[model samples]
Target: MPVTDIITDEKNLTLTVIADFAHPVSRVWRAYADPRQLERFWGPPTYPATFTEWDHRVGGRALYHMNGPAGEKSYARWDFVEIEPERSFTVDDLFTDEHGDPAPGMPVMRMRFAFEATDQGTRMTTTSDFASLEALQTVLEMGVVEGTRLAMGQIDAVLAGLREWFAGKGTRMEVLTDTLVRVTRAIAAPRSVIWRAQTDPVLIRQWMLGPDGWSMTICEVTTEVGRSSHFGWAPDPGVEGEPFGFDDQLLFLDEPFRIVTAGRMTGVEGPTVTNDLTLTEEDGVTLLTTVMEFPDAATRDMILGTGMVDGMEMSYARLENLLLTRPVV
Candidate 1:
């Protein structure tokens, strides 16, 4: 993993990253501006990755979703803040519920991507700002550094592949997603392990979620509550597959108490749905209840018809079983 500068703050935490590539400014710019290109380079590329809702215009919205390892899933959104063709772009990254409302325990992530011409090609720089020191530390502890490093590497590979294609050697492929998949696991392990699995992006990549053939390129935590983090997962090179994806924002996160989130299906980008997951002790077994509330009749029908809720239940069951069978040593 490439090391990026990790800047600390007494009040505000910030992260700055810079990378140079051997590609023209226009090509580099297209990789960032085009959603289709984005799907190829972002996140865990090995997992099935898709860009469900992409509005690259300024003031527009972008959303994405992906299936995860061990029956885990993820979704997110962003609002474009500024755009300047090939020079710079900015966005306010946040976690929204299914209704597009902000959620708790997540912090606001303001990011700016700048492209500058260089002797070799173009130098791309990314700067991420957080609200406070605690938020920064929280995110660091949650595994932003490693995740970001992996994601940047994938971006580099994508650019390289694009260049090769321009040289008359690569074949272009189309990305697709037929249906949304939700995986649930039932684990008997203590809630602490479960918490680690949920909070730490590293562990999340290990087992939580990844599309069919892609890997998690980036997973960073930006806040504790009412904030949003940035996660990048993309398709692995030469892999053609789709992971069930969603576009959700975290609504509530109470540590081991419960978690609530809302978002829409990533494959179709339809109505939003809210999910409430509660972890309670039942006869020494953790009773995990995941209830998904749809915003409209259409969404409810979609959830039911797709069997995503059932999939979620099965995933939860697997998690519970894993926790129970393996003693937390």
Candidate 2:
């Protein structure tokens, strides 16, 4: 686990938490940018959070609720003030009502999250400036300090999951004939679990998303060869892009080892892409290698420019979280 250091300044009425992650700064940044990933570790383990609103851009707002063990809920909101991608962001946070409005007499906290690249990995420093010393003390009395420590402690597990999606230090990207791209990741879970998560609709929906607030509106899978699998994503409200998805035909299935699918992006102009997914086990971990062949180099380059790689990495990180926390059936 990473060391979490907390600092309190009574004179300035502020609190700061500094922690190190074994993953890169970009990977740590996604944990805050993606709402679904944020919700997984935002609150204490006993009080998990559900984010109803999330916008990572400046001037945006986020609304969420933390559900306690007895079913009680505490609502909160963050008003984004500044945002620098993969570096830092500032927000004004406050307790809110169930209707998404700020509650009266609640302490308003100005918070900043800074991500810095380091030799060990990424160092994440979070500082919270309270309205006054009294306000800071009030939160401290409510166990905010301990709860925050517990919540931040979960990042280690989150990073562990993300590391598996990154393909480790030797991840190499080669353009074979300019039409094929191969990406590999070594996952800690067994091959069977990874296969099930890829083929089962229920499990697929858990992790196959671009970011938070986006949802899979349709996920239907047929494992048998020659059958078709359909997946669709509905973007969050006010987002610019059209709902995008894929329609895939299962061409090959080798149980918990390999699967080959020929698919096309729905509502997009592109030739069919054949995806070859292979999984192998070493010791107790599984190595997943995926090869995607596009119809042409132009099409491949065009897709690459659309930030699809970042989205895929975020999705894979979510998948790692699911595999780590979900019960095996």
Candidate 3:
């Protein structure tokens, strides 16, 4: 039950995480070196993980598959550089293809993990080295620190449960089997007023463009379950952006009450994404919730890095403002 601290060396472009656990050396070591254990905590809370080619020996390698909320998948790799049983190990970690082919950039990571004997358990120090300060900044700016911490916290719970089971005690550990981001926003208007803004292109033009730096380029609807629709976005204020639009399959709907759509972000050709939008009414207020399921952790991380959340937040703000300005019809 020791503390954990994540540190950054701005000059050397290094990140360090120090943690302690009540588990023995063997248990803690397995948690990091075992593929099954590693897979249980590799990605964010939202997705299930799969690992392959995991050989935890010196010079051996491994690949992992991260399945995202939308059923899309991304891959990562690790080449073990050094391994000392129950003590420490070092590896190169990065995004890669299933065959261990490196991805688009030289975003290589040198990771060193050391375990020291402590009074009751073990102290683990994990450090990562990047190519440059810019690369380190890039990951941090992409919310890697927060995301990794959340994943590791899940690991901690698993380890704790193992300890409890070993001590002949009942361990009730909860692994987040699934997580959905349900966004809820209230518009102080009748359900029909909000529905009009959602359905009427004229009313959509008033607020859906999202002010500046965001514009909806395409909006298509089929109004059927197997049928599909598309909506595109552009950064330009007025002009439509190229390749901006979604190809969405209508999954379910309860009219102005609920909607479930599956679609991908419009691209020439790549992975597909699915999103669900739900609408509800409460005491003369309209609530809208959007839940997007990504294909994998890499895609999700990439989308987050690309500032999608900021745009969504701004769009929500504009909708709220527009609703306030327009009188109830």
Candidate 4:
């Protein structure tokens, strides 16, 4: 949220976003050069952007699509016009169709990006030039200023090292959008070991239990895509609570790295949420990131209000302890 100035000039037919950050110019520039990092905050928290093609050189165009919570996509193409590493760059940004072709009737905006070093750190200025006042107004009405502010607010987390920023934070949850939420936790375990602890039914039963008073009654796992996994838990002997389970269909599986699933409460009828779980390891610590897409904002809030993150923190802590005492084979 370091935005200092948001300017709209009717005579110039342009809009600009200016922000300052406490980082070197080189470091701030890499955030845009790397697609993996760029996608982290390019769009608003709600509609996350995914780059399908990345070519940063002049005459090359980058293609990306922002995914909406309800399975909608808004595609964009960026044609690089100029490049001066760590100094300045320009691009002709356009709304595009699924095929990356310019969508008819969409106004193309010429964007200039400038980076400069300051006493505190770095400053970034982005200016968008439109063909006419009407074109500028069109994007203004699209909530471009607010969305850019919120998106830029995420730059701090991206600038900090993952371990430095998130370690010891138990569990972190962010409402990305009305129907999408992101959760993250850092585990002091290797990537493969953590993956096995999650997917192996035998290991799962050991630490997947929510709390001290619960026991995993059912631990069914499926490693293959297009399969189903089921998990159930019940109160331990003498404990007072109802048994519950989750039914999940595996849609995508990348061993030791990522998995995507459609999950719903077992025996309960409604919509199935899409969960994308990814693990990245740094310095022997695995960062667990889960992006959950719910059916609606209400459904998202309901589950979060149920102490879901608290339960997850308990399970993750148990998993960490189990890993320490009983190292994976």
- Global local distance difference test of model 2: 0.78
Q: Which candidate number maximizes TM-score?
A: 4
Task: Return the lDDT, model 1, position 166.
Answer: 27
The TM-score that candidate 2 achieves is 0.51
- RMSD of candidate 4 to the truth, in angstroms, is 3.8
Candidate RMSDs in Å, in order, are 20.5, 20.0, 15.4, 3.8
Best by lDDT: 4
TM-score list, all predictions: 0.47, 0.51, 0.51, 0.78
lDDT per residue for candidate 3 within 203-231, as digits (tens), equals 66556664385666676656676787777
What digit string (tens of lDDT, one per residue) describes model 1 on residues 1-329?
Answer: 22235444445467777777888889899888777667654654223235678888888988765433222445567789999999999988766564445667777788898999989888877888888777667767866665565455546535655323223312121111122222223344556666665667665555433334556565665335445444545677888854444445676676774566665645564676655554433223343444455555565555567644444444344444455565443
**Weakest 10 consecutive residues of candidate 3 by summed lDDT:** 168-177
Per-prediction backbone clash count? 67, 0, 11, 0
Candidate 4 regions exceeding 4 Å error are 1-12, 43-55, 65-75, 96-101, 132-154, 176-179, 190-193, 222-228, 249-262, 269-274, 281-283, 293-301, 325-329
Q: Candidate 4, residue 153: CA error in Å?
A: 4.7
- Per residue, candidate 4 scores C-alpha lDDT tens digits across 28-133 of 9999898888887787754668899999999998999986543468999999999999999899999999999999887899999999999999999999999988
- lDDT tens readout by residue for model 2, 104-179: 9889999999999999899989999998898899888888877786577556645566445344533344454467
Q: Rate the local accuracy (lDDT) of all candidates.
A: 0.58, 0.78, 0.67, 0.86
Query: What ranking of all candidate models by lDDT puts the best one first?
Result: 4, 2, 3, 1
| Greater-TM-score candidate between 3 and 4 | 4
Error of 3 at 147 (Å): 0.9
